[model samples]
Target: MFSHHGHGHGQYQPPATGPQHEPTFKIFCRADEGYCLTVRHDAVHWYKDMRHSTRVKDEEGHPAFALVNRATGLAVKHSLGQSHPVKLVPYNPEYQDESVLWTESKDVGHGFRCIRMVNNIYLNLDAFHGDKSHGGVHDGTTVVLWEWCKGDNQCWKILPWGPEAYAPPPPPAYGHQAYPPPPPNREPGHGYHPAPAFYPPQPPPSHDEPGYGYHPPPGGPPGAGYGNRLPRALASEPTVRILCRADEAYSLTVRNGAVCLAPTNPRDDFQHWVKDMRHSTSIKDEEGYPAFALVNKATGEAIKHSLGQSHPVRLVPYNPEYLDESVLWTESKDVGHGFRCVRMVNNIYLNFDAFHGDKDHGGVHDGTTVVLWEWCKGDNQRWKILPWFCFWRDEYCSGLILYYSTMRCSRPLPPALLPPPLPLPPLAAKAVEVVPKRSERIAAKMALEALEGPIHAVSRAQRNLMRKLGLVPERGPVTAEAIAAYNALFSKPLSQEHIIALSSLFSGSLPPGKAAEALVVCG
Candidate 1:
């Protein structure tokens, strides 16, 4: 359940568990198409307002931002750079400070909101009347601070930095491949099954059930009568995309309580379908040709034909004993290059012609109005099946993950994420010294200004982040509340001696680089 009380703060569980060592990831803002969460020159606040790169490293050659302090329930940012301070900040290592941390706050299904843990405020992106015409990003747009309101800008998608998050490369040539007919003993002859009762009693949906929303008519897994002998060969293919002869990609995507042809992209995991021969329900047509149900990877639902009205085809929870004739189709080489045809139960060809407008995303057909048409050997009538390959030991290539692209590892499991037997190796030395030229100087000034306040505590590294951001203000105009705010953020309180040393170092207006080194030993 979600709560709308107390400024609309809500609780949410992350979609996936993060790695143990707090791997760096790129946080993308959903409101904008391709902007990334980036730190400003001040290094005090962040905004999802920068164009991101797809290279292995950022333009500055640094790993992206990492999620840290997982146990604290606060998302602290950390850069992977060796010289970077142990504080939460974006990928820019030039400026380091007490690092800003945020909490998930709420999960609104499509996206989630982030609340800055430091000041209990929500991160927001300025929406220009809901039209992002050079809005609150770094393009001279205004990024203002606001209380927690759960606006669109606050919602984000934090994805790991690696190939897993990337779009698929160019597709392979469209090659048509068909599953071999089941061994003899499969009785021949096919006739349409009787129409099922209208809106048959439906079981309430459950998260526990594999395919809850979709179910086959007469309901159940395929081949209920077929013994539980698992076929070893059928599960051999791994990740793949099915191509149509028309040169467009065809996939069994979620449609009105079933699977139908929807638009596909390299990142679509649902595009990966499976064939379970051992338990697959095979039906032989009058000509003795065999067809099997195309099963979904996430849910075991198999493509089935519904006898209701339009003779619609849908994905139903598999049930072997149901003896459903609509769910079966025979694959034959159609009179076209690189394409095969699917013969539906009525001897009509399966077609996606009528509902072509909404091809990019998926939607239900016109309730069987144009589900099937006479076989015309058109683009919509042809189909192709691609097989998945195994990663390690190419032997036993079976099953592609329904939600991820390619079988390759997104990234190697970090040493800390592994078991105790494999300890985290010490970090190697940096081959180059990438210092913050201007931001660090400015950031150091900011840290000093905050230290001069009543709280009177500052760290050597914290000042380094502000070094180039700007020069320090003269030792005046510091307030008690500002000092208290700075003090409250420090995990380790600075001692009296350390405060006196920082004050003296600032009084002289010493060189930024040497001043940081002096404070290192003051404590």
Candidate 2:
């Protein structure tokens, strides 16, 4: 018999008695009769019908074990702070960190043990809306770290891992025809035994019911309530915004060729980046984390490190054939809540230099330049990467209904069906009002020429002009190989736009024919 009066602290027992092997087990919450702990899409949740087996491996010279999940092949880990939700992460045996290791307390009652961290906080099923009065053993309720209160929700019953534990029992046997005959080679009670009549077959819980398996995060979806969103892992070439964890308002932005921390502006093209798909075939860091070039949406340049402490990070033209290591980066060392360190080659990390002096002078404010610094385990170095679409969805159609309407309709929509116009910032609004004059366009072209300065100065502009004229296919990046391909296919005469663009490039110093020759030579 179990008593509920005491603190419930009992003698600790190893999950497995065997010395040479670790046994897999299922953790069933005592508060929820049939519900067992499982991981779905790397998020910890309780499921009655579906559950993953977990094995405990003894840590050398430590009392705890690394709780590894079979589904994701990851270890159950949690942040250091109390009341944080437990997460699944890649296990590193070389560095057996405390976050990935968990200890088992003595059985409180009926073989239910308290799984706790070394810090004394027990693994707890989160209460409904954080209300302690309501037992949060409902299906899909997240598991979090909390101080032990001797509640049944904190006590878990470890059973031998098997599908039969959660699988529905066979229908009550009526006659001999209900089950197949036993195997001929087996003994009388050896194999293919029919299910007991006393065990009733209960219907699985209906997932369609409200509050059954759908527990949306508080305050809705990450940014602007985009509705049910796909996980980052499922998205191929997801556009992202690198936001500094120290100051949520600031994000990694390309300004005047240098990469720095700037106030997050959703409308700014410089802030949005796409993971380069060209390097997708070979995009893993040293630690096996996904790595790629952060290609800017507006400039078509990739973020690159110049390879020294004194050099500030800059954006360079993106070329897949160059095989540049400086352009590659990876997100590693999860700090919590989708934040991690953006690490470059040679162990250099992206750091927000906020610390100035003892007194608070200038720290993490707007326009703070980001630099490549050594790992200091500071919060300034951790960054939260968010999908760019979350912040920029105002200008585009979102949600299934909107997508259906846009795809199905051919004519103009009714007033009620029309999407509301997106609000533009003051600068964007002002720029949209002005019409560009020919002189202004020429002056802009002149400015670009001055910036490039005589070293393949007109190559980019010419390539753009060729793309516009259909001289080159708009499929991939304009690299040296693309130029050679275009030259081989060059048979059509130059268009008027080409002559005009060429004249602008040379201040009309060369004739039309001479400029056309020069363009081919440049190619």
Candidate 3:
């Protein structure tokens, strides 16, 4: 038995065989959510975060996040009960999603980024599996070190810190460990269990364990005088932003007795900096008139030296053409975001079903063209997708993804997100079918009478679905079937929205998740 020597504060470990250095791990990852897993004891532990429940069917805290060891189909998820560590034996890997974003690399100096939007709080690569926004960057950039990217193996192994690192994670009270005070009367043969009487005596907390009930991150600046304010017990985690000044690579961690780096000069790029008139710090310009000035904290004056000679202020880019398409359409303003023009569509904008020469870049008007590039704004290139799809759907609501096959390869739209909400919906029913307004009743009558036009594939699918859903009687033309189906579908005077949700069967641009909402259940 041993204890710390003098003031050295060294941890004395007796001989037992498990890896010595403690490590950190991420347990769960989702794009919109932040923290998923943290290293506690020798094992990784997980707890549900608010952002996660919105994306998946989280039944309870029971199954916090999925973990699996490749060699075994199921890996036991180890947890801490009130006292001892309890192991929930083997869980299926297929049901659980796992990614070794940071591998145990041999590359010592190599850096790793925290996937904030998905896993940790620094960098995010991919949010959705099926969508284009896989990583923060689209051109196949792995934002962090992963085994898949074929980088040096060291990319995965991140060294937590130096010798004087954050204090060690609390020791696990294994099932075999004994409690304090031994026992009131030690029966010669029997040992103590974690019963009410055998509760392990807790050691007095050290300076590392903030005795004050304070959230350290928000507890003003580090080393600030919190002399009066202290928590009964410090936070279990204290987040630190780690940055490699050499590589500008960064990772953030809740320094929970684990050594991680610190962040560098972090700045928000959305601010505008205007110059001053005299160029002296003394002559200040109050820039909060039309917009607030991004000023230096030391001097509450204009950002640049002087204003006279064309001080290029950094204002947020308002280029409608450069903005995300959905945002542009909603705000009805062109922030000069990018939009590509195709000769086929003779326009610059995106449309999943927009028929054209199907080509790009100055092709002839054969409407059978090829070649596509990123969209940008020119009059010929000035574009926006129609915000309303057939009046009943949320247009462009991640509708950019089209599972189209020019050959056998399905081309997915870039910067698109995966089909969230599970099993992407089948295309909405009935909505795609062109319907005559009440004013066009005569036209509808004429169309029914003619019956000469080629039926579109979507329209045909609508007919089939209607028949399948028992909306129409068997063995009849689509118009007749439609009439019967419409009568059966509604009791109230249904609007187009209600009719489509109830009777839609068209297989066009439906988001995969809404397949059930748009389902036309067949007989």
In the order shown, the candidates' Cα RMSDs to the true structure are 34.0, 22.8, 28.3
What TM-score would candidate 1 get against the native?
0.29
For model 2, residues 1-523, the per-residue Cα lDDT tens digits are 1111111111212223432124455566677655556664211211111111132222211145556553334666543223546665554343324445566676689888777653223344332232346745555666776667777777776565443323333453466222233245633211112322211112223342211233333554544322222223322455677776566656676665567777766556567777664554555654666656777655456666432233355555555554554467777867763467776632333432323311244457666666655566666767766664341143232332233223233443576765565443332233234422222211111011111112122234445544543444575333222332343333234334443445544465655445545665643
Clashes of 2: 0
Q: Top model by lDDT, which number?
A: 2
Q: Which scores greater on TM-score, model 1 or model 2?
A: 2
The parts of candidate 2 lying over 4 Å away from their true place are: 1-238, 280-283, 348-361, 390-523
lDDT of 3: 0.23
Minimum summed lDDT over a 10-residue window in model 2 is located at: 443-452
Q: Residues 1-523, candidate 1: write the lDDT tens digits.
A: 0111111001111224332223334554445535544332211112221122122222123222323222122224321111112232123212111123233444655755443322112223222222344343332233333334445654556655453322232333369322233235532111111223311113325543433443332455545322122123333434445545443433445444554555443334355665533323434543455656565555545565432223345555555444444355566655553356665532333443323323342323322122444455456556655553222122111111111111122343455533233211111001011222322221221121211112132333333332311222234233222222232322244444434334444455666456545555542
lDDT of 2 at 220: 42
User: Quick one: best TM-score, which candidate?
Assistant: 2
Order by lDDT, highest first: 2, 1, 3
